[model samples]
Target: MTLSAQLGIIVGYLVLALLIGLSAYRLTDRTAADFYLASRTLGTVVLLSTTFATLLSAFTFFAGPNIAYHEGPEWILVMGLMDGIIFAILWYVIGYKQWLLGQQYDYVTLGEMLGDRFGSGLLRGLIAAVSLLWLFPYVMLQQVGAGTALETLTDGAIPYWAGAGLITAFMILYVVLAGMRGIAWTDTLQGAFMLVVTWVAMLWLLTAIGGPTSATAALETEAAAHVALGSDHYTPQWMLSRALVIGFGVAMFPQVNQRFFAAGSRTVLKRSFALWPILCVLLFVPSFMIGAWAHGLDVTVPADGNVLPIVLTEFTPGWFAALVIAGAMAAMMSSSDSMLLSGSSYFTRDLYRPLAEFSSRDVSERREDLLARVGVVVFATAAFLVSLVNPATLFELGDAAFSGFAQLALPVLAALYWRRTTRAGIGAGILLSQTFYLLSHFTTVVPGTYAGWTAGVVGMALGLGATVGVSLVTTPAAAERRALYFDGNETGAE
Candidate 1:
């Protein structure tokens, strides 16, 4: 009966998602711009919700709580409070400028803008490559979360592989069918569902576990460390580093950056960002508290740190538990679909379009759309295979993904604001930073002694240094090009 209830809830949720996709498909036009970017028609609400939903991924749903369960509530401080402010600032700083440029130039991808700015196919390819490297792992994290959630919810009745496949299949169908329009619409719905279910589940759990006061009291008595913040793991430097990396890195994610192109206007973008911090507080506080509460509960946390399902099954009724599981699944699928779409867009717009003999203007829009859909399938399948391996904890995988993308922050900023930024300099910065980060991952060069400082931070600093130093020695971009981006009142230079 329990298994049937759980299956029914999941199937029902997926059907709703499919219907939303079909609706989006019905409205979608055949143009590449319309297919890839929703014709830049997203309003304030859908823009905010889709970006919020895409940003808060399986990592937040599963790994965040898992970290809090073991490490204490400091995870909330690292991501919930600090990350909220950090990303909000970035949204204002990077997003507005990107939207302005995208509006004037009709750019659908970040790589396209950067490549045109620098006139370097190498730079374009580099950005796309780095994005894919980080994006692949992040997408795999969603699959892992989905598989683990279902496996735990059904008590092994549904295997991990089956769970992962189910999400992959649904995501592929919806994304390929409707593209960005479908993704945004579905994301808005999923985002709202996630917020409501998570809050309700948290309130219900708190009440059942003798309220917040009782939970904290139990934690203090049984595991005082879980309530406090003196662990060797979280240092001031470490926390600050995490805040910076995630703040800058998340802003540059291909999927998130593409949303800049999807916004109807600057007003819509601003309105969405204004509401982001509040949403963060609502969603993350409860999630981390749930994990902290689980530390004090009688339940045994799983080895994989998938405590959400265990808590839901043990504390909540089967029906409520199933719905909450669906919410979690919603978070995973929303993020996965966005990432898959962005990855395909990067390949199609940045990589293939440049190298292909056929002019994009000359080619049929249907052919281009078909190619993008194929890329989506290929990328999703690869990510699914990686999820089967289950390489690391969700937190660790998320950290790696953030680190790789964060390295691009310096280069991206330079391209936007620093007219003196040369192609060689930007290329040097990206290559050096990524190389350093990769080496640090494999080697003991960057000791784990510091709390928030990782190889990624070190690499970012090096990349920034390299960019500045190289730009000094190299020729600056043309005055016309500089004027195009930086000159007041002008949209862009033709």
Candidate 2:
């Protein structure tokens, strides 16, 4: 495959994506539901595809392979396998309930639901602000992955900044123009392409090395530490622990919550949850192979993270390579658009709207809409800028944010089921927990804060304690407390 031909195919795929977005524009453009939740009419197929697409992003495609290439097979084969199943089980247990509530409340975003549940303006704003802050680093990591892939695939013909700019421009136009419908519809197409290309790439690489048996043998000899399970630093316990974090944390991701809200109904959402683990197997396993294969073939590069793209370009023919590049871009764009929309929704519903005292008819409502649209551009631009300056792996930044949110999992669960949990306690606990988690992340001076998830656990523990203890000490407000906790009417108990 010549470079020109590869570029041509890539452009053709982009055009197809744009057409899908344009076609879905009318479906998503009309009202609040249409814009934010795809009119609450998404079926099972669309929900499944969009869910998988949202999960399989730059980190999964590029970074997972890179981890396998560098660390060993345990990181992907063992750890990743556990992650898929665990995530599915967690979703089955709690996710359906959230979906049911979302339908009952006509919820458009996670912050909206949380605000209603807590019955506090300040807590909602805090949660929204924290979500936005954490999301920026996650988005920045995605932009970095995409820019690196484009630059390396095109051999620096497109610089990192230029690559970031191109993707951001396309996403902004795609997301703002059609909203959730455009994002989901385009994701359906991209997710399909990426899955097909992944299998093709795997088969091609296997064939390139003669057969699976021979390839395994070759990898065992050449990259013994990386190819074999439990080799090097790959222990079963460590792998299982890592998998737990990844699996559980995925649910706590704000982007995934937004996806849950995007579904039309509980049935569609439940089906998507059940199917996502299988989708994870399809996308994540092959990426692991790409890494191990790259290692066996001795295809070393300056940046280990580029191993996936480098392998795609090396093992596959020109046209196939072009398709692979397009698939990678698809992954990047799918996740990016979801994050942009999720972050913007936080700005609109949680911060701006609440400050207006939940009134949709206020003068500030129009300004808030404008602010959200503007936020889409500003957030995307910040991501691009951060990627250009310091390139970090998507997986690392994602895990950091994941761990941060996982701390809130306890509080969220408590808030949902425990009526005795007071707003003051919930608010104070989150503040303490998140603060401890950050201090643990940034500074090593404090002992016992070194365990990454441990920080979240401790923080959440203290926060929960404070919430329960404080509520016991102080009397709950008669009107608001009863309305919020007793009747299960976070949306005014109608």
Candidate 3:
């Protein structure tokens, strides 16, 4: 397709998104709950669609398929299919508990619930800090993806910086003007478009590459001896370890946590989680297949990561290819909006609120919502600047940033089920785990960091141990505070 036609497609998509954002403005409530949580009024269909679409981002559309092309079908087994199942299970097992508590406590951010549970502002502050820190890099990822997509669509006439800037501007405008209401509705439309594009691309790729049997045979026949599973590489240990690192670390990310908390009810959350696996299968199965098919077509893999886009252009028609490119933009922007909103919430509620000593009870909720909107602009600006430099550092920062947050997941989970978990203990655990995880992440000599997943594991272990030990040594939180943390409802007689 010519550059003019591609620009037309891109403009049309943006206009459609703008209309949705404008329409949702009336649906938005003036209060903090309305802006941030949608007044807990999200129905099953809206919640499910938004969550699924939000989760499917630039990484899923691009890198996921690229992994399959380079690594063969085993990559699907190792990362693609299993990753979806893990998310589904997480929703049921871990997410349900969070939903149950969020409703009872009327929590907006995960940090808010943590602060209340642990009876410590500092702990909540730390969670907020970690969330904001990690989320910057995530926003950077979307910025990079948007730049890449536009460059491809415009045939490099629009540079990466210009494209990223445009995306960042759109995100800040929509999020600030409409808040979560704007983001949720935009995600609904963007996600549906991506879904259509994915299936169309997949079907065409399969036909162009021959049937399933041919694709499978070609991959197996061309497999490198060194790269094959059970060789020096891709062994049982290597395979399982890689899967666990990508699965667990990505799952523990706070952006996903925001989605879980956004869910209005336990039933809606459960149904969404259960249905996510099917989407994962449908979206990725074809991408992985296309990756393998590339081997037979003798197409030089672009940048190791560019394989998916390369194959799309090579095999699909121009108009269809342009649509898929626009879909990539949709996927990237959906995740960006979610991450920016989450980061802003953490900054406003967890960081600035405590440090400024504002009483949540006394403040006008409208003012609080305004602060969150301002924070979104601040975060997006910083992310755009960071995109100007080395983009890969963004993902590395993700690893370094969230080690602390991941450690607290254990204490947060513990506080729900274990009544005896004292504030002092949980607080100590959070400190110890974060300190150790950061130190370990920097030190290659440390065996744990090489393993990648060990940062969270080791951090959680140290944090938990120290927390429990400290609580036993010191006095517990007041009986009333303890009741609220453990059971969600206080029974005064107890």
Candidate 4:
């Protein structure tokens, strides 16, 4: 196929997405609840689809296969089996609780929920700041992946900036257009599109290479190190760290955490969690297998290039390859739009609204919604600018974002279950743990990982310990404040 024809396929996909976004806008009201939480109307299908698509980003589309291609297929253990189960359990433990509270209190963002419970505006702003800060890299990562993927597939016809900008522009439009309602619908479309394309690419590659049996034989004969697991990269320490970082960390991401509030009912949330592991295997198993098979072929891959794109172009037709590339873009776009939408909520509600009130200026819901939309555009532009830097590999940037968000998990857990958890305790936990995690990553003041401990593990341990110990020493929150979250008379009350 000609370059124009291949590009046309991608263009058509974008137009379809735009149409979806527009259609979703028709169903929406201008309220913050409608914009951010879809009016709490998500059913199991849309809830599961949106959550899955939002979490499956450039990291999964590119870095996942890239790892399996270079390392062994043991990545399946971390990303597929362990993360699938762990995140599902977290959904029930954290998400279900949040949903129950949200149903009664109409809580939208994690910061709002925590801040209200602790009766601390500073804590709300701080949590929101941390969320927005870590979200920037992950958002930039999607743009970087989109740009790099386009550059690779066109064999450099498309410059990196153009590709990155294209997606960023579209993502900003989607969030600003329809908000969560539109994004969720579009996410469902994108999720199914990418999942099928991945399976097709894997099957085609296996057919061209004779079969999985043949691929395995080739892997054993050549690149035998990767054919087997438990070597350099798949050490117990690294593997466990990946699972811990990805599983716990991902659940607390502003985007993913927002979904916890969006669930229409406990049944919808329950079904989504129940089916998540199957979705995990369906996506990760094929993606990682493609990478492992690519290792056996030892296909010539460019510097910092994704092997899946190279292998697809080699074995598949140009149009099919173009379609598959669009699939990768689907994953990136879905995740980016969610990030922008969620970040906007944090900014306007947790950050901007509080500052406005501090000045004795009340923010109306209409004004708040407008500010949130503005936040989306501004943040998208910022991410696009950062994407051009090429700071690190997809995995490195992703792992950093994951580890950063993981620090929130422990403090949040303490808040939900322990009524004795004080504002002082939670505040200390957030500050000290986040400070340590940042130092470990940015300054090398501390090692990012030691032995089997990723920065996230170290951070979470410190956070939990601080929360428990401080809560013991400090005064508990007022009795009335605790009743809203935990009534001793209520069954199953914390």
Specify the highest-lDDT model's number.
Answer: 4
Pairs in steric clash, model 2: 1-318, 429-463
**Local accuracy of candidate 2 as per-residue lDDT tens digits, 1-494:** 56778778877787789888888886545566777778777788887787778877777777778777776555556434644687676565546656766777877776677677766677778888878877787787777777888888888887888777878887787777768888889888888888898898999988887877887777888866665457536655455545655665666666777666666667776676667667777777777877876676757667534788888777778688768878888778888888888788888888877776656557455676677789999889977887788645666676677667766666666666676666776776678777877777678744443233345445556667766677667665433343443344455322
Query: Root-mean-square deviation of each candidate, in angstroms?
Result: 2.7, 3.5, 3.6, 1.5
- Give the per-residue lDDT digits (tens) of candidate 1, residues 1-494: 46887899997998898899889989988877887789999999899989998987888889988888887888888886445798888787788888898989998888888887887776788899889989988999899999989999898999999999999998888788878888889889988888888899899998898888999998888788777775777777787777777878898889898988889987898788788778989999998789878988898986785988889899989988889888888888888888888988898777777767335455555676788899999999999998899988888888889988999988888778777778888889999988888777767765533345767777788899999789879886552255556777644422
Q: What order do candidates take by lDDT, descending?
A: 4, 1, 2, 3
> Least lDDT summed over 10 consecutive residues: which range in candidate 3?
393-402
Clashing pairs in 3: 69-291, 425-467, 429-463
Local distance difference test scores for all models: 0.84, 0.72, 0.69, 0.88
The TM-score of candidate 1 is 0.95
Candidate 2 global TM-score: 0.90
Instruction: Say which candidate scores most in TM-score.
Output: 4
Query: Model 3, residue 94: displacement in angstroms?
Result: 3.1
Going through the candidates in order, what is the number of backbone clashes in each? 2, 2, 3, 0
Error of 1 at 465 (Å): 1.2
Comparison by lDDT, 3 against 4, better one: 4
Clashing pairs in 4: none
- Tens digit of per-residue lDDT, candidate 4, span 176-289: 897899989988899888889999998998899999999999988877887666897688888887798788888889999999999988889878988988999999999889
* lDDT, model 1, position 409: 89
What is the lDDT, from 0 to 100, of the residue 222 in candidate 1? Answer: 77
